[model samples]
Target: MLKCDFQYQHADFSLNVELEMQQSLLGIVGVSGSGKSTLLKNIVGLLKPDQGYIQFNQHILVDTRQNIHLPMHRRKITLIFQQALLFPHLNVKQNLCYAEKWLAPSERKFQFDDIVDLLDLNGLIQRKARQLSGGEAQRVSIGRALLSSPNLLLLDEPLTGLDVQLKQQILPFFKRMKDELNVPMIYVTHHLEELEYLEADTLQLNHGQLQHN
Candidate 1:
């Protein structure tokens, strides 16, 4: 299980979150500035909370009282934003390989060939990030994150710019990932429809408070 109880203070607002998640796709829904991103950041160790703790199973991610804050890379968590953010100069395959460098020798790395076939990224593997379409780039982005072998996956508005056709093309990959892999994911989006296809347990957030709607 993934558990977090943290409060982060920003200039505009403070975010207080207390949540527990399990081995399934958990979807977060909120408007912009509703603290959805802030909550995710705290979970993934991107933003440190002023107080409280974060724990994934037996691992203590953050405990402000104990001053135990794990760095982002050591958390075994991967976050993929709306933007692909792949290295502009690197080809698709290279981008996927980049994640391997962070893995420990004992840790498992996702097989590149399997990712290619699952995401239908064969021909585009040689193409640079700048050369791919938005949907294609997002596919590559998901491929790269998956290959990193994270214990938890955090997706931030992953379906943002895609049209209906692209959404149709990409959603099955997410379904396949959930069915075929045990990796737990937190998918965040403002539109409820985007997450319906994933069939994730919905968590609603508004102004830093969590609600089940």
Candidate 2:
């Protein structure tokens, strides 16, 4: 579970969002510049809120009133950006293995090989990041994130760049991750159709607020 009640200000723009998530998937639909990504960044400690708090499960991540702010690396959180953002010099397997190095064997919830199988990355293992197609790269990216065994996953418009065919192909993998892996996720997107497939608890972000969609 996750709870965030924060007010963040960046020069002329501001974001005030408060929401609690318990479901496996939580979707936030908003137009560009509507503060969806900003909310996520704050949650993961990439950006500290000017005021308010964030708590994950029973742990406090940020509580400005108490001067508590957990660093991004210590949050046990993983963020997948709009772009695949894989390391260009690393092969698919190497990129995936990168996450494992940071975690102890016991701390990991999933095996490396299982992630490869689930994400359909067996053949792409030897391919360098640049050699992958958009969809392939995204799949590898997802595999890499899952391999880390994050307590929470944050995805920001992950399928935005892919064509409809590719999106359709990748959506099922996400569904499988939700249903089979049961990982909790906060998915932010401009597309409502994507949420329909995930069956997420849907919310809309409009002018610094959150409401049922």
Candidate 3:
């Protein structure tokens, strides 16, 4: 449902990739500084590509030739970073509720309660963001992203700093989101074990290019 053929340059580093994704969970494996994040930023419109285009389903998200570049907010793409960037003052429920404002009632694909349940976050609702464990915070972040009803989810090494136990705890949730909730995701990480656990279709991102793993 997504297609990209773009070239982006940053100082001495350049990212040139051509990728097409169907409605499935895709994993991108790369070492540090391999332009994996750069490719994602370009797709999500955080950084405009110097040339080529990006199409999501039938919508043209970027077309440098036509001078068409949709802003990040308008793309309906949600990005989850390595850290759980939840609002410090907001409780878990409140942080999740903030994402609900992105789509109106009729336009929403997933309900807030369903997301909370899917993430197994019912008990954590009343807790402050800073009061949760690493795994709990990540679950809340995932729930918040799902509540936003994004057409495509981009995860940028979301489980980076978590321990093996914590990563194992959260991996099943991602599988459920793919198997049950049917969320299309592009998960980028250096850990191949995570991809193996999810049984995701794998690709290797090396020197700004994509190849079958």
Candidate 4:
């Protein structure tokens, strides 16, 4: 489970949110700059809260009063940005292997071949990261994150730049990742169509606050 009650301030906006999420896909919906991405970043430890706490499975990732703040790598949370963000010099397989290094030998839960198969990445394995199409790159990115065995996956408008056809192509794989892999995810998007396909519980953000129905 994940629980958070935190606040952060920016030059133009302040983020104040409290939310409790269990082991399931939880979708965050809001307009651009409504603090949705900031919330995810905070939970993932990319940003520290000015006050309050963040707990995941009883681990206190951040507690201002206790002066506890875990770094991003130690938190075991993965954030997938809107862009694929693959290493331009690395091949697809190399990118995936980069994350695999973080997993303990005994805890390495995912097989490389299995990830390739799951993401339909066989044909792109040998290709340079720059050679892949947008969809292919994003697939590689997702596969790489999965190889790391993250406890929580934060997707920040992953499908934003894709065309409708490409978005449709990748949608099934997201479902496969959620259902077949059972990796709890927090997907941030403004699009309701994508949320419907996820069939996840909704956490709506408005004026920097999180509201659930």
- lDDT, candidate 4, 102-181, per-residue tens: 67888777899999999999989889999999999999999998999888889999998999999999999998888988
Model 4 — which ten-residue stretch has the worst lDDT?
Answer: 101-110
Better of 1 and 3 by TM-score: 3
Candidate with better lDDT, 1 vs 2: 2
> How do the residues 1-213 of candidate 2 rate in per-residue lDDT, one tens digit apiece?
899888999988899988989899999999999999999999888999999999998999999999999999999999999999899999999999998998888999999999999998999999999999999999999998998889999999999889999999999999999989968999999999999989988999998789999
Model 3, residue pairs in steric clash: none
Off by over 4 Å in 3: none
Best-first order by TM-score: 2, 3, 4, 1
Measured with C-alpha atoms, the lDDT of residue 141 in candidate 1 is 93
TM-score of each: 0.95, 0.98, 0.98, 0.97
- Per residue, candidate 1 scores C-alpha lDDT tens digits across 1-213 of 888888889897988888888757999999998988788888898889999999997899999999999999889999999889899899999998898787775786578799889899998988989999999999999989998898999999888889989888988999998888888999998989867888889989988888886
Clash pairs of candidate 1?
A: none
**Deviation from truth (RMSD, Å), model 2:** 0.8
What is the C-alpha RMSD, rounded to one decimal, of candidate 4?
1.0
**Whole-model Cα lDDT of every candidate shown, in order:** 0.88, 0.93, 0.91, 0.90
Question: Which candidate order results from sorting by lDDT in descending order?
Answer: 2, 3, 4, 1
Q: Write the number of the candidate with greater lDDT, choosing between 2 and 4.
A: 2
Better-scoring candidate (TM-score), 1 or 2 = 2
Model 3: per-residue lDDT, tens digit, 75-146?
999999889999989999999999888577997888888888889999999999999999999999999988
